[model samples]
Target: MIVDPAARRADGESVRIAKDVLCAGATVRLCLPDGPEEWAKALAKRGERRPVVVGDDRALLRVVSLLHRERDLAGSVLSMVPVGGAVSLARSLGVPTGAVAAARAVLDGAERRMDLLVDDSDGVVLGGLTIPPLRDGRGAARPASPPAHPWLSTCRSLVRGFTARPARAAAPDDAAPTRLRVEADGVTLADLDHPVAGVSVGPAARTGYARVEVHPALTAPGTAPPPSPLHADARTVTVTGADFRYRADAVVTGPVRRRTWAVRAGAWGLALPPRP
Candidate 1:
């Protein structure tokens, strides 16, 4: 078990419950260490022990990143208690929100080998995408930031819900549509310069599985193109353009001229509760 100290103060009861559960099971080891690096190092030395993360989504991402970097994901079983904020990924994976329930699920759960998305530099177990219409100081298209906590994101949603505003109407001659060339499995789907809103790629995307999504710059009125099909289960994808930036799993990494992505199936095992 790995626990983030920062999260303990905010979620003491959940942490205590998780600790009791683990204590009852003598086989489990608790790793409430100083920081991520130490925890990762400890995990690296532990070989294939079943890991139960006690933080939120960022904590999960940290573990996934470490596993991917160390090439130790093949046999690892990852479980989570969702003790902190920002647990969207956990919720999406069907893990219960409460600590006792999550711990129980961890103890009585199944092992699932899931697909992961590998890019040139990093591997994302959840999803990735490239969004147009850059915000802040970032130029052109850039990836959005991953939420810090699940509750913070919920607050954002609530705020948006209460102060929603109408979108501005589009007009002609705003800006010429930029050309985008997309190819998947030796097939060309888009090769025209038009007002691009967003592009998404994923596996079983409509069902809310792992996927890649792209949001292009807003179009002007009638210039918006119809929704295009994406190769959700594509094994490889190559994207290139000068006017766009790239983001992976909500982290903007590059504004390069070209980028490639490959999917690795059954790359990692996760400890998760059975879907209800």
Candidate 2:
């Protein structure tokens, strides 16, 4: 079993539970590495043992990345005993949240194939990806010296409420709509001529594709944005045209002007609780 340093530091109880459970049922080997180099060495040394990760999303990502680089991801079945503050990736992949339950699953579960989103850079996103808007977009679009002030803001809210469109996802204070050209399966979804509020991409269950959603920038107050934030599913998604950053699962990556992620059907195997 590999225990992430953060997990050991943040939630010792969960780590203890996982260790105890695994030790009771199997011949468990404990690996406590201090840094990335040591962690890689530990994983590299696991010759034939089915590695069980005891940590959160980042920890899992690290393991998958290592295996993928080694070209062994398709053949390896991974067991995870998530023990940290953010286990959203694990939960999304059908892993139990409770330490005891997840530990038990590690020993009792069956190996299941899982889809993955892999970028051109070999980065993996187990949960989802989000590209928040650039903050300056709103300022650029703001009408200068409007006398209505608060009234305009109120009217925009009212119109949005009555329109029955999906509520706009909140972004960070600094986020602003950016001009990006987005494409999926060779089809253009958004062009650089228009700024976009945000973009989200994630694996679509059993569909062999990833769901892509892009929110358009609202230029004028009390008016609905044109094209109503496109949504689609595709085997490949590409974003280009401007230097942009995105959050993949819990980790943020890039400021690169272009990136493409392709769905790898059953790219990795995850040990999940066996069905009844």
Candidate 3:
């Protein structure tokens, strides 16, 4: 078990509960790393042990991204216990949000193969990837995953209850509609001639492909964005624009001029609670 330092600080109780549950069920080697260097060292020495991460969505993404870079992610069969407030990413990927339940799943769950997207820059996106993210009333990106609790609706955090913010001030234009050329499976869905309000791309469940949607900019103030935005299913999706930033796996990335992401069917394995 790898306990993220942030998780230890965020909720010691949940970390303890997860440790106890996991230890009771099976032999465990616990590594408490205070920094990324130590964290990387621990994972490198893990040998044959399947890693169970006890932390929030960021922790999970760290593990996956590291293993992916090392080219071992496909076989790592990772598991996660969402122990912090910003865990919607893990929950959306089917991990239990409760520490106890998630730890139990780590021990008893089945290894399930999951699809993933690989960007041209070699970055990975596990959850949905959004270019010009979906905006809320305040014009900030909505939580990457729908909150499981009703009270979360009012929290305006970028990743839904995730309170961290980029250092940049006055970011209203970041969420505004922008020009981007979108293509899926070689078909152009949106072009630079017309700006798009948002572009969402993610793996379609059980389809071994990506589902792409491009919402056009609103035609009038207070008027709904045009209905029936362009949509497609494809093995690959590409976006090109002057400069844009996007969020994937609940983390923000890039203002790159172009990015191409290809879906790799069953690229990695995750341990998930057995379906009822």
lDDT of 3 at 272: 94
lDDT of 1 by residue, 201-262 (tens): 65654332335444344455555555654443457666666656655555666567666667
Give me the candidate number with maximum TM-score: 2
Q: Model 1 reaches what TM-score against the true structure?
A: 0.73
The better-scoring model by TM-score among 1 and 2 is: 2
Q: Number of the top candidate by lDDT?
A: 2
lDDT of 2: 0.86
The CA lDDT of each predicted structure is 0.68, 0.86, 0.86
lDDT of 2 at 101: 94
For model 2, name the residue pairs that clash.
Answer: 133-176, 134-175, 134-176, 134-177, 135-175, 135-176
Per-residue alpha-carbon lDDT of candidate 3 for residues 1-276, written as tens digits (9 for 90 to 100): 999888998999999999999999999999998888887898999999989898898888888888898898877889888888898888788998888889989999999988889999999888888887433345446657877887666665546448665555545555556788999989999988877889999878555899999998865579855777887898999999986889888788887889999999888888999989
Model 2 misplaced stretches (Cα beyond 4 Å): 137-174
lDDT of 1: 0.68
Query: What's the candidate order when arranged by decreasing lDDT?
Result: 2, 3, 1
